[model samples]
Target: MFAIAAPSASAATACAKTTDPATPAAPSPGKPCWVDITPYPFGTDGLPVDTSSLGCPAVNAEKDRGYQSQCYLRVTSMAFRAWNRGLAATTRFQINPSPPPTPFGVWLFNGTRWYPDPTFPGASTCYGDTVVWAGKLDYWLIGGSLTGSGVPTVCRYDGSSFAWQPLEIPAETRVKVLSPEIASVRAGACYAWDDCWFFGPEGVRLHWDGTKLNDDTPDISSPSLRGRFGSAAARVDADGHRIGVAVRWTSHSSQDGVKPEDQVRPDPGESAPAQLLRSDGGAFAPFPFTPPTVPGPDDPWRTNLVAVDLDPSGRGWVAGNTVGAGNLQITGRILPGRQAAPVVPFALSGRAACTPSATAFTYAPTSSGLPDGQSSYIWNSLSVFPDSGDALAGGTERPAVGGTSRNDNGYAEPVLTRVGCAGAVTETRFREPDPTTNDAAVAPANYRGSLDAVAANAANDAWAATSSGSAIGGGIPTGVDQRFYQRPHLYRLTDTAKPAATAGDDVEDRPFEVVADPPIFVEDAPPPEPPPAPDEPPVITTVPTKPKRVKQKPSIYSPKVSKPRRIKGNRYVMVVTFRVRRPVTVGVQALRKNKVVSRSGLKRFKGKRGTLKLEITRKHWPTRVRFYTRSGSTR
Candidate 1:
């Protein structure tokens, strides 16, 4: 007998390439994600860069109904050093350098191709952290100017060309806005800009009415307002309209010389660092309460709000991290609409814990599970697709498994997480070839890049940008200008062919294929041979019991044998019988010798019966016969 062992498909790696069940699957209802075709450098402009902003079809575009008509467009920011001449090839589009010798440019994608927009006034000086938002009829671009004029610039696209405009603001407000965010609103659009600081009145909000811009700067003089707001999301609510902002307080008021254990407890009456803001008709106010203490034994590590987005239910989601010794520990929560918001932290794995309570954060499981890498991972932006209602979180992560540390001259992976409307979460890490191994066309054990911005269309198509390329082997060889290799990259996550998503531990047996115990074949053990017939004493007729038969002729009539039955290996048993007209002798024997192997006692003419049982070890036949005298002759 032979046996075959068939296990579950998910438990085995059927192909050379398989999803690491250890990592989170890419957003749900889709296959795992792979690195996009675009290439970007690891670091540029002597600072960290990311694809900070994305513009797709606006969520409220359909609300405008008949007045809305637009194509899918995605814009991302990226910067390169002035000395990098091979930068043009780093992006999907051509990087047309400006007269001021601008090294950076904004890349545009129209479904199939990438187009570089280099005429945006200070394109060279702009950091790849460009803020892009799509309106009903135009697309807006806002960022700092390269001229170092301490002024932020805005460029509007009129379908055909871009018109640049410098904002009119007091120099005291700090002409440059480094971390800027834009949200589409009904009146026009609302934006949050800052002077690269958290304290004081360093943050400002700009409300545009399509024709003019108004300033709505909040008060920062109060210690209560000593935080910075970098993330903003606008949604129409019952209270007219609501714009939700993520506030990350930059300072801890007291407990200077406190011990580690004592540091976990906040000073009495101390305000929470993570707060929510509600803005109605340009009047902004706090949400009336603070978040429950996040999981931590140490004071929240260099924690800052980096990403914010509203789910289909209008609940706000925030993602940030507390900086640790060499890495950043990430945590997030969902902000409900009510004033008394309940603390619902994201379920994290390992030593991580939320503050005030040891209750584990609840998180939806992924195919491979959530990323528990050893190093740091930070989210840069988040947005919800209007049509699919899927929430996307974008950021960069240093893979816990491969390569050296960023400080040790290594790489990071760009990560995109998709959360379904039904609360299913899928995480995907982008994989790319190592630019450093171009000569041999090799991939780094851990490829690194930053996705600063992400935008998705109604079709569920998405796009992201890498602000710069790797410091090592990242750019294509350009003999004319070596600096061209340090260019940034833009990529699209369109609906393309991909592998099926693995179900992991969630896999279940189908109804028609339920599991069952294996069958057993008892070949070695055989049925026991029928017990040998008990030995019988010879039969003798008694004179008184049996009347004397006188001159009775003996005649044999019929004979028969039972079919053989196997009781053991190559062993069988059979029975035979014969009839006699008078007291006749009968015998059963193998035909080979014609000798009785077994015999029956005498029988009377009334008929007598006997039994023949034997084991057939080899091929043989048994014949039964009887001899008797009929009349005076024997036949």
Candidate 2:
């Protein structure tokens, strides 16, 4: 295992690149040009930032608007970390749930001082995204908390102090809302949507007033409907109107690896009862989905969406995670009228998947292995920041932005890259020497699936949250062995009046570390219990257990309506690796006007090669399907 060193005065301290990458010109890996994340030695070789008598950091800005600038990061000593077991306790990579929640804040860098955002809401708020309204630049947001755990509140960052201002939605309006993926325009108020989260069987959307943000079911082409949503990305569009979107991954029966904890209600349609819904502003008509483009069978799962900025002019872009099945294709809808989707061409191979919901368990690939020790907890939320465009003649276009790449160390940190400007999703490894990793862990050095949420601000900065530590000593991720501390890591990358740093210089800068409040102790507790085996029947046997066999009849492919299974949105997967010899193939389908519109598909091959394309597939979402050859079924 090679290690990344801190930037030093001695001889440039050079080392080997983690993965092989092409030029940045490539759109999808298939494209001729693509670029990998260039590394620099700015980190402290995993050392804590020296706060000392130096007190808090002073506010700083980049030198010129075009030359190289740096944010050499610094982690606050008060910061907590939860690594190893805490992350894997759940089957998927998500935030670790604490019996008692902790509230904390991290002061961020805006050139100079580390600004602060107070504690995370109640217990349920861990996994989700954040949104910053750049139009209101002096302030930013740190929202996307969970329901019951907390209402989605926006925090204000005024250089020094941080405070929480709740999003105001009219009470009594029962719209189940999740973390909102938002986008702000240099003009108009910001707009956001809840791609996932639901109320009484449906998901909802909201609006953010500078003071308090809340739910505002924007009327759409189709009636605002509901579905299962997961990861989503956003950007401003060509119109300058803040046209953002949220995505939910849902299916008829099976979805993701587990059965839907609950079912979707009020099918998008009613008379005959439509299944999906879309919104325009006044009413939510039936949202007509076209079999939108998706990365192939091997890519990570993501839905395509676009947003437009609004004001004296207009500008913005679209965002979608490109790594599908194996295609790694993401696109942008910058041009108005009829614009084609841009396919990202950088293919990162090692990422593999397909964990099916109970409905499609039989179809998952047989031998695919998961990133070691990784488990996705909750689909925390998505936050879109207001786009602050620079002045230009002949109407300048809105800058496009998207997802963060994981450093080799395994923790999925973020990066500020060009979604359409440069091409392909920017990436690195979740490896050691990461200036990040301020929490404890479940297993030693295992930081993959812990984060439950992700958020982004106008200046191209983003934040991802997860629970890393707990109450006692030697728990999942206790002591100095911390990693994700069940806290939010506020990471920001800005395009200032400074020149961009070379790949070398970029890696050497220090990341500003924000310390947060201690975990909050949750009230109203419930009794803890045991779970069941994945494929086996319950061992419960008593009276009715009197082995009674009825004459079972089988004919037409009558769907086998089995009893529902129990899952805590609580448990985590054990740290384990199941590998596949090759890549698995996947198929895709789109829905619109309450009917299936288009269908496309791609393939993802497997590999350990230093450099490879990692495309997330449609099969990985809602129905996170994973194929297992030995079981002769998917799970």
Candidate 3:
């Protein structure tokens, strides 16, 4: 219920430590020794800079990167850091998805810095472009996107800088590609095989072996049913060998061919697929699954399996959201194997009972019951701790209060869910410092944000990157006009630390130790000078010239009237934010009190997207102005 205030000096305000009780300070409660790398500095929140992916790959033995732990973060620009160094280096180029068909760029960290792999085209074009180190010292980049010809293309790259090649699969006329995943079969060994799976665009599946990419669409036995559709995959491997994968699928047609309106409506038969399969290099072995029913006509009925991994027992544990209408419910499943039955309530305790709409559901703990009326709980990233076998999930919590669901209010808060190896689910929340107290700023006050990527290190420490809103409009209004005021923040969750406990049956209320990186800095241009007082309208004096009568009735001649010359100040700041292909030169002219004060030299703005403030000032307040880029007039 607390609010944040705008900066007194300028409309541009960033989330930082505040002295106000309403907005607290950060850093003190944050995890100790967590790295705080700066975000991409060239652009505003959205365009050129985007921290799209984060990974804490095991330090390769080949590269003695003196650090004990290393992290790679990719935005449209790429950056990486070795924990021991405590500093990050970034690429000069603002990576953007090249036009359709062209591969996006990919960067690699050799040891201390990051370098773009020339073998790969533009910056990573899609989220699926993931780097995997399997058998030998080599690595692979699996990526997917629609080609210019509209053909869905999925390709891979070798770590030794080999050219990217499309996975060889049976060519179908048209297929939409889902995100791709690569499961490492061996830790340090090279010859062991890794599995790459791609699903979607009508239940089509691409299974890539170490040697070739195969169209494994036939793995679905029920061809008559509507094809499976979903974008998450989890494969469990044992001793450098493949075990199986837990995939979520929705059947187009069940035994009962219900009407389009009737399908997905609150019904017992609405249950969908959450199957486990073991493809032994030939065909897929199937296991039975019962999707939970929906809660209401507008609630979730069908299940979606997105995150999956194996428990110590080698049984399949999967996590996903059940969504429909406007509501969403998190769901998890335990696959006992081909012949054994699936367990309904394997993780998280609440919402165990069945509903007409959603037969199964997982409970998410929140302080305020059910969140804002319009809020939805999203659980996107999940990983298993190698040391304790516990599962960690991260996502965004968008409360319904403050601003409407359609508005920027209800800023998102990052949430981490810990599913103990024994299935005890607990939720922890993190936010930027409020300047008042670090612990007081547990949730963001403005704009929308979410956790996009998450990974767990060998020490059971979890790292996540979240795109959250700037503290622009918690309760305070900066009166600045802009489409978005959001930025990204990185977080580290330490398992060994315990948070000050709170009282509640809801597991989410429990405290947990977490450290947040400094918020990405976004400069706001001061408000534009109030439009120069509009020039006064000319006044017409109707002198006693009523005598001006011409032939017919009277030929009325119009008299030329001139408005007083308007004089205005010269100093003004022209703020502009835009994305570009390459840097362009900009010129500005300032007039003070009806006279030219200064003309700035041509300044170049680097592309893809950047925020620029061209300030022209003299003794008087700036009034009129002219601006130009090489392309021409910058209106």
Stretches of candidate 2 off by over 4 Å are 1-17, 21-103, 118-129, 137-163, 167-169, 175-201, 208-215, 218-224, 228-242, 251-427, 430-635
lDDT of each: 0.38, 0.25, 0.38
Which structure is stronger by lDDT: 1 or 2?
1
Q: In candidate 1, what are the lDDT values of residues 1-635, reduced to their tens digit?
A: 11111211122222111124453333333432333432122212211222332321322322221101111112343211111101121212222233233332444332233334445443543332344433222344444333355444344443212344544433333432222321111011232111111111234545555445555554434444444454555544445443444444333212122234212222247545334555443555565334433343344423444455553235545555332211222222222111111212221112122222232222211123223434345566676654555656676655455434221132455556666555566666533333344342333222344566765443324545544333343233332212212233344443343222211121111111112336667677777999989989899987777668787444455667666555455555555555655555443443325544433322233456544444444455445333323232222
In Å, residue 586's CA in model 2 sits off its true spot by 72
Write candidate 3's Cα lDDT for 1-635 as tens digits: 11111111112123232112443222233332223224322122111222343332333323221111212223321111211111111222112233222232344433222334445544343223344433322344433344444444555554222346654334641232222221111101112234555544334665556567666564222332223433233333445443434454333322222234323222234343334443333344444445443333332334444455443234434555543211222122311111111123232112122112121224232333334355445565565554555666666655545432233235456555566655565555443434222243433522344555555543423455554343332221334422333345544433223222211111111111223335678899898778678888999887675567665521111212122112124433444344445555665555566565555545655645443344443455456555555565433
lDDT of 1 at 418: 65
- TM-score order of candidates, top first: 3, 1, 2
Candidate 2, 1-635: lDDT as tens digits = 21333222112222212122432322231222111112321222212223222432322212111101112221211110100000001111123243222222232232222222324232234322233333212233333343452433333333211233333233423333332322111111223221211211134444443334355443222322434332222233346333232333332112222223332323343322222332222223443333133322321122222121111122222222211111111122111121222211111112121111121000011122122232111112222223332110010011122113222322222222233222223332112223233342222111322223333333333323332211112223323322222211222222221212111111111112223336668899688777865797769866765667896432111112212111123211111123334454432333333333333223243542111112222333222222223323223
Give the clash count for each candidate: 36, 231, 42
